[model samples]
Target: MSVTSSDPRIAGARAAPKRGIRFSWSDPLFRAIIWQIVIVGIVVGIGWYLVHNTMQNLAARRIATGFDFLDRVAGIPIGESMIAYDSSVHTYGRALVIGVLNTLQVSVVGIILATIIGTLVGIGRLSSNWLLARLTAFYVEVIRDIPLLLQLLFWYTMLQGLPPPRQAWSIGDTAFLSNRGIKLPLLEWQTAYGFALLGLAAGIAATIWWSRRASRVQEQTGVRPSVWPVAIGGMVVLPLAIWALFGAPLVLDIPALRGFNFQGGGTISPEFSALLIGLVTYTAGFIAEIVRSGIQAVPNGQWEAARALGLRHGVILRQIILPQALRVIIPPMTSQYLNLTKNSSLAVAIGFQDIVSIANTTLNQTGQAIEVIAIIMAVYLTISLSISLFMNWYNARIALVER
Candidate 1:
């Protein structure tokens, strides 16, 4: 006998492995994979068929489909745009670019304002003062109940009802509010401003680096270095120094009445004003609820434990509560962000001329409805995916790790 092994596992392990597909319904993993592949194939096939059929019908009807329309001159009159755009000079592409910028301009600012307002309202909802809590609750209820479209219309009408430029409400003679919209002093921009901005950006980057280093040092030494000094120097002092170095240009272009309207200054159009006010007010209501719920979702024990540590109320809330609460808050917050961006499309109703408004104009003028629709879908999908990815990454980063 040559050390005969009776164990089935050892014998099987020593045996040559079987090769080739074993088509058995009892093999769960294999069957599941096979079914998934089959389903995916069917979906792909159906999609291809639909696309092919659509193309055939379009061609038969002589409906041209391509992005070539983007090259055509866009004679569409845009009231306001971020970039240099003229109906007589620019192509459809440039007009669309302007629309995108306008949309981003509204969306980015709306998101920031909404987040700040919502967070405050959410905290206020749990305030010790009965009046503050009740007031915040009232705000959330009333704002959420009313339709956003109606709000937009109300704001637009209100702005339009303002007095003419000649008799406009003056803010210390530096700004004016009129039916033409709010006119403010425009910065006479210079190279020095750009250098100051660059210094600010660099400062921010340096602050971040120093913060990370401090965090690592704290982990190793159990003594946390304060990051505020660096933050202030980087964010404030550095920019001021750069600006002073470049002669500290602080020129302004004050608006003056020109015939029927104000000129020579920055103007916030009524359309944009209405849209931003509507979006921020409407979205902040929902976001407030999300924030409130997320905060409440934390166990009472967490609060008690934080208090036991003798940490200040602000520090405990910021360092202990929020980190845990974010897990609940972020997923819903991402949805609200997407909603705000998509809702910006409603700007068309108020003549804000966001991306959707521009694309609609493009389709009507070019007779390339398909292309324009595709562009719209692609833009929204890209933005939504980007928000989702960032939120998901952040959520995973702050997630509690198991030992």
Candidate 2:
């Protein structure tokens, strides 16, 4: 070292270590804080300007601003309501509640039906049967290509074009289909129905616990328990037994043609029927694609390994492939669900009184445009957030963890 040549490395080695720059603007932590402060300031400034402008406009027009308008009587009649609602007696707030329930009813039912249809189609597209696969592929292509609104309108028109009530199509007098709508026998609920529902809830909880236990058993003994039988017994047999013990508290209200319309049973309005059909069919197409991609993403080696272990096709799919494919399928599946929910707002176009429809009517009648819009936004935001949280939890539960 004392006899070092004119080499930069040797000279540097001989020299004392240099200190790093301190308190520089390039420091990550300092830069982050500065950027954050700037963003906050910009956001606050924008929000204040908007609020001030809104206030000035409201004051100029002498328009009263508050939620007190919610208590005013809603003179408009809702076509379909889950709860008892009268135009003369109910407030706008109550109307909005009815609308919310209607939206939930459609969204929940649509989700369940879409999932079933989509899964079947997804599996069909991968089937060994040529005809089935082609048909599935055709279905996905046709549905995914068409506009949802047009499909909804078409369905509504078809429903309305059916024969009138007097000449309606009947299924053994148990159900009736006509321009009026589809009328089916209704289940009349009694006080014991509450207990039966609780029993069903308990049964579902038991099924979940049993499934976890069965998984552990399979891991230890390399033998899987017959879970389906146990699950069915818990969910179906136990619930029925509980219902029977409670004197089977259900009454069937059958529909009968009376005068101009079918009377005395549950009825599905054409608007609701159309909206449900469109949402399910449209959303199912996207879900099918998601599922197909997920299945294809699983390595061929995994399938080969399962086959080598003498596993049956069903077992291979259920025990191995599905578990892996779900890790891929769930995230996109969640987005489809959210899309279906938000698309339910399209019910407004056809006079199916969803939250948006009701809110619009409220805004027009009360001239509370700002409040109505705010309420609608809040409702949708809440629903979307709730769904996102649930999906995230489920995704985490199924996600792969490397050790």
TM-score of each: 0.85, 0.84
Task: Rate residue 58 of model 1 by lDDT.
Answer: 94
- Please name the candidate that would achieve the greatest TM-score relative to the true structure: 1
Instruction: Report RMSD for candidate 2.
Output: 6.5
Per residue, candidate 1 scores C-alpha lDDT tens digits across 207-297 of 9999999999999999989999999999999999999998888998999998878888899999999999999999999999999999999
Query: lDDT (CA) for every model shown?
Result: 0.89, 0.90
Residue pairs in candidate 2 whose N, alpha carbon or C atoms collide under 3 angstroms: none
Structure candidate 1, residue pairs in collision: none
Instruction: Candidate 1: count the clashes.
Output: 0
lDDT of 2 by residue, 1-403 (tens): 2535888766654442343333668654456568899999999999999999998999899998999988989998999999999999999999999989999999999999999999889988998999999999999999999999998998888988999999999999989999888999998878777777787888889889888999999999999887898788878888788889888776889999888788899999999999999999999999999989999999999999999999998899888887899988999999999999999999987779999999999999999889999999999999989989999998988774511
Model 2 earns a TM-score of: 0.84
